[model samples]
Target: MNTPLLELQGLSVHYGSLRALGSIDLVVYPGELVTLLGSNGAGKSTTLRAISALVPAHGQILWRGGSLAGVPAHRLLKLGIGHCPEGRRVLSRQSVVENLMLGAYLRRDTAAIHTDLERCYGLFPRLAERRSQLAGALSGGEQQMLAIARALMGRPELLLLDEPDLGLAPKLVGEVMGALAQLHCEGLTLLLVEQNAEAVLEIADRGYVLEAGQLTLQGPAQELLANPSLRAAYLGG
Candidate 1:
C-alpha cells in the first residue's frame, strides 16, 4: 500500500474548555479526493484548521511519515499544504488578480506562479473575465471560485478545502463541485469538507462523516452513499 499523504492520529481540538474534535483518525492518500462530511458545528472546519496549524490541537498530523507538530501555518503552506478557508475570505479591497498572487507569496518560482495563475483563470473562466475586478464586488459564487483559484495558485500537493459550497445557488454549487472534480482528475489531492454529502460523494474516492466533533462513519464514498442509515440520516432517502 502507498504511504498516506496525510494522516491524523487521535486528533482532537479544544476551544478553552469546549472540545471541538474528539480523537478523530483519518487518512488521505496522494492523488485522491476525500470528503469530510458533517452538519453545522460538527468540527469539520476545526479539522481543516488544525491540519493547517491554524488552531491549537492535540495529537499528530503526519505528512509523508513526518510529524507536523509545532510547525507554523506558513511553513506548512511552503511544505505543500494549501487551505481554502470557509467564508471565501478573499481580500475585499484587492483586485481578483492580486488575491491570486498572494496565494503564491511563499513560492519563489515566478515562472511557475505565472503559469498557475493562467491555469486558475482557465479553471474558472469567470475569474478570467473579472481578473481585474475587486474581489468584494463579485457575487458569492464568484468569490468562492476565486478562493479555490487562490488555493490552486499555491500549487499544493494536498489541498484542504472548507465548505466551498456554502450559501450558493444550486447551479453555482454544481459549478464549484465540477471544478473540484476536474482538479482531482488533474492529479491534485483534495480534502474537501462539505455538508453537501450527495454532491461530494459522487466525486470523492473515500469519505468520513463527523457529528458534533466526533467521527461517526467512514468508508469508500460509494459505500457510504449506499449505506441505508447514512442514506436516511444525511442523504434524505
Candidate 2:
C-alpha cells in the first residue's frame, strides 16, 4: 500500500483538566479529501490545531512515513503542510498580493513563487481583481477564498482546512466547496474539518465523526451519509 500523506496515531490533547481529544488515530492519503465531521465543542478545531503543531498535544504525527516530533509550526510550511485556519485569519492590513507573498516566506525559488502567485490569481480571480486592495475590505466569501489561496501559495502536499464554509450563505458554501474539489482534482491532499456535515460528505471520499473529542465513527462518505444516526443528527432528517 502507498504511504499516507499524513498520519496521527493515538493523539490526545488537554486543556487544563479538560481532555479535548482522547486517543485519536487518523490517516489521510495523498491527493485524497478526508472530512472530519462533528457538532459544536466536538474537538474538530482542536484536531486541526494538533496536527499543525499549533497546540501542545501527545501523539505521533507522521508525514510521509517520518516523525514530526519537535517540528515547529513555522517549519511545517516548508515541509509542505499548509494550514488555512478557522476564521479566515488573513493579514487584514496587507494587500491581497502582499498576504500571498507572506505564504511563501520560507520559499527561496523566486521564479516558482512568482509562477505560483499567478496560479493563485487564476484560481481566485476576485483576488486578482483586488490584488492591491487590503484583505479586510473583501467580502466574507472573498476573504475565505483569499485565505485558502494564500495557504496554497506555499505549495503544500497536504492542506489542513478548518471550517472553510463557516458563516457563508448556501450558494457561497457551494462555491467554496467547489474550489476545494478543484484543488483536490489538481493533486492536493486535504484534511477538512466541517460542521456542515451534509455538504462535507458530498465532497469527501471518506469521513470520521468526532464527538466530545473522541472519534465515534468513520467510514466511506456514501455509507456515512446514509447512516441513520448521522442523518438524524447532522443531515437534518
RMSD of each: 0.8, 1.0
Instruction: Give TM-scores for every candidate, taking all chains together and pairing residue i with residue i.
Output: 0.98, 0.97
Kindly give the stretch of ten consecutive residues in candidate 2 with the minimal lDDT sum: 119-128
lDDT of each: 0.95, 0.93
lDDT of 2 at 83: 94
Off by over 4 Å in 2: none
Which one is best on lDDT?
1
Model 2, C-alpha of 203: deviation from truth (Å): 1.3
lDDT of 1 by residue, 70-118 (tens): 9998898888999999999999999999999998888899999999999
Q: List pairs with backbone clashes in candidate 2.
A: none
Task: Evaluate residue 4 in candidate 1 and report its C-alpha lDDT on the 0 to 100 scale.
Answer: 97
Candidate with maximal TM-score: 1
